[model samples]
Target: MKKKIRIKKALQYFGVPAVIDSIKAQYFGGSELFSIKLDYLEHPLSLRLLGSDVPTFKKIFIEQEYDFHTNIPPKVIVDAGANVGFTSVYLANKFPECKIISIEPEAENFEVLKLNTKPYKNIVAIQAALWNENKKINLVDPGKGSWGFTAEDSDDNDADLIDAVTVDYLLEHYKLGHIDILKIDIEGSEKEVFDDTSKWLSNVNSIVIELHERMKQGCNRSFYTGTPGFNVEWQKGENVFIARDEEVMSPR
Candidate 1:
């Protein structure tokens, strides 16, 4: 009789995942969008910032591929929180025909994002924040505690009111009736942004979101997921993707 393979023994003998990851990082010099071999999984695995610090673009590319396999080519992609153009670059490379609007409000991150995406022609870098309406919002980066721009830290001094616009307003102002993919990573502001999503939910085909479980405060939006017409696949980590089976939702 063949002996059962003990999980811990097997992991130790074959080298644990963390050890393997360390070796890969040292050998590969951080990861871009590449088919990386990991453990027993034959499928390619994506490691965040494999070779660079905060590889935002690479992370987005890998995250989107988790469950999003659309045959219909994307026409436009809206990146609500383009940190350093990591995802923007990946999306542009994947869908060369698609136009990307990368929104970043953090001054420090925006500088990097702009430089990183400068080589791409399809990406439009907008240093702003999306809200329920068009207005100025206090931009705050609570250091390592948060991952988005917000008004929470506004002291009414040294605060910049970024241009805030709803998805509907953007579609109408830009004369775009449809958005192929809407990727939002606004830290915890997704609740407010989603509150107005109903206006354009029917126009969007696919949505990728990173829900901040801790950001539930001050948010009044509630999502009805896994319904008959709505299809949702929730990734363990804060990321989630939602799509419509019948028709895509378009704002404006």
Candidate 2:
């Protein structure tokens, strides 16, 4: 049943020929990267894995995880923890005029992200981890594959150091007056980012996040506490959509 559903979705997103090619790449093909061509996109999306990226790709392209309805076209979109630039690419295609900043910590994932987003001029890929402060941190991979990397403060010399930046820093560095859409999937780092939202929370108009309460406690508490005036717009799959007051969704 699950297999049938997945195939159905794949056909809907990638069409018949791409789906068959994907299956062939999964079993028969070896080592070579698989490419997916969508009618809506100008270039084919390159997938590094036959298995690891399928679920993420399905969630973004097929399931439309980040599909939020807004009357206002966002001017600035920030994709924190943008794994291989899937959501960034999706949004870039959806809103070609909007400026998108795609942030990723993992080295390999950042490389693939650059490749995937190369066709879109509106997307600016930044290789860094989103954190509460602008500092160096260690990325901990808890065996949850590529999308599950988390950031933690560490002084150990052997630790994998990754550059971490705050939302405020990004705003200042890029000269963005405000963020219209802030999409966060930074593993368990939401607790830290939302713990004290007084600095940057007010500047954001909307948020779409996947809470990682199972990975780190107090995530829900911090998020809700930080976004007091925001209204819960909707939830699809694991993502929660919130907007800054009900008027944000109202047609201008």
- Evaluated with lDDT, which candidate comes out highest? 2
Could you say which candidate leads in TM-score? Answer: 2
Candidate 2: TM-score? 0.86
Report how far residue 155 has shifted in candidate 1, in Å.
12
Q: Residue 118 lDDT in model 1?
A: 78
Backbone clash tally (model 2)? 0
Candidate 1 lDDT over 132-194, as tens digits, reads: 677776776554422444644232444456777788876887776888888887877776776
Give all TM-scores, in the order shown: 0.67, 0.86
lDDT at residue 73 of model 1 (Cα atoms): 66
Q: Report the Cα lDDT for candidate 1.
A: 0.60
Give the residue spans of candidate 1 off by over 4 A.
1-52, 55-58, 61-67, 152-159, 218-221, 225-229, 246-252
Across residues 1-252, which tens digit of lDDT does each residue of candidate 2 receive? 111224665565556776676666566764435687877776789764443466798888877777766776889999999989999988898888999999999998888899999989999999999998898899987767778888998776655598999999999899998999899999989999998888888789988899999999999998888887786567789988888765554211
Clashes of each: 15, 0
